[model samples]
Target: MSATTAGGEVVVRNAQGLHLRPATEFAKLAMATGCRVQVRTDAGDANGASVLELAMLGITQGVTLRITAEGPSAGDAVRRLIQLVESGFVV
Candidate 1:
């Protein structure tokens, strides 16, 4: 398991932050990468790659989340995920 440090901060723009649907989608994307990802927020920390943990964060619209990805594809994963979040997780 190769590891690297990747980080970014994104604001929740989707009127609902990462709720069930967005979180699920985000999780699915993370899973596709087969890398370990984690997210941190003022509310708490979550397994960035897990839909369940991400949903549990209860992130609300306008909230800012600090995301980090570390694993074989850490750089790519972090970049894409940040883009996802910035794009309102549309992808």
Candidate 2:
């Protein structure tokens, strides 16, 4: 078996953007997927499991982000995360 790489783009829809709470949520989910995940904006990228790194990206609302993951679960991980961001980080 080989690890695969996959990604998806989503606009930050939460009113407050990827703040500590949402960033924490995103990080937790990313970690749960057991993938080498990354999230990026036009300006910079961050490790998906690091809330601090995600916050440093300054992901304001409406900022488009590309999330990539490399692992056995890459594709599903990308889809799962994209849904979270698209839903305004509801859960």
Candidate 3:
């Protein structure tokens, strides 16, 4: 079988934006899904599983991000990730 790819757009809702804590949370979630995730903005792209990489993107609040995931559970991974961001990384 071949791996599948899924992607969608998600907006940052938190006033603080993708700060250290939220970036770490997002990376952890992406890593746990066992999928290769990538986040892209008009500025550039970064590995979704790496907190440092995500932070480097400098994504701010209200920014619409394009997230893509590739792996056996790509679709679910993408959906969950989008939900995470849209929900403001609720703790």
User: What TM-score against the true fold does each predicted structure earn?
Assistant: 0.88, 0.95, 0.95
Give each model's whole-structure lDDT.
0.82, 0.93, 0.92
Off by over 4 Å in 3: none
Alpha-carbon RMSD, candidate 3: 1.1
TM-score, candidate number 3 = 0.95
Candidate numbers sorted by lDDT from highest down? 2, 3, 1
- What's model 2's lDDT at 71? 93
Q: Which candidate is the best by lDDT?
A: 2
TM-score-superior candidate, 1 or 3: 3
Q: How much is 85 displaced in model 1, in angstroms?
A: 1.0
Q: Which ranges of candidate 2 are over 4 A from the true structure?
A: none
Superposed on all Cα atoms, model 1 deviates from the true structure by an RMSD in Å of: 1.6
Worst 10 residues of 1 by lDDT: 1-10
Model 1, position 13, has a per-residue lDDT of 91
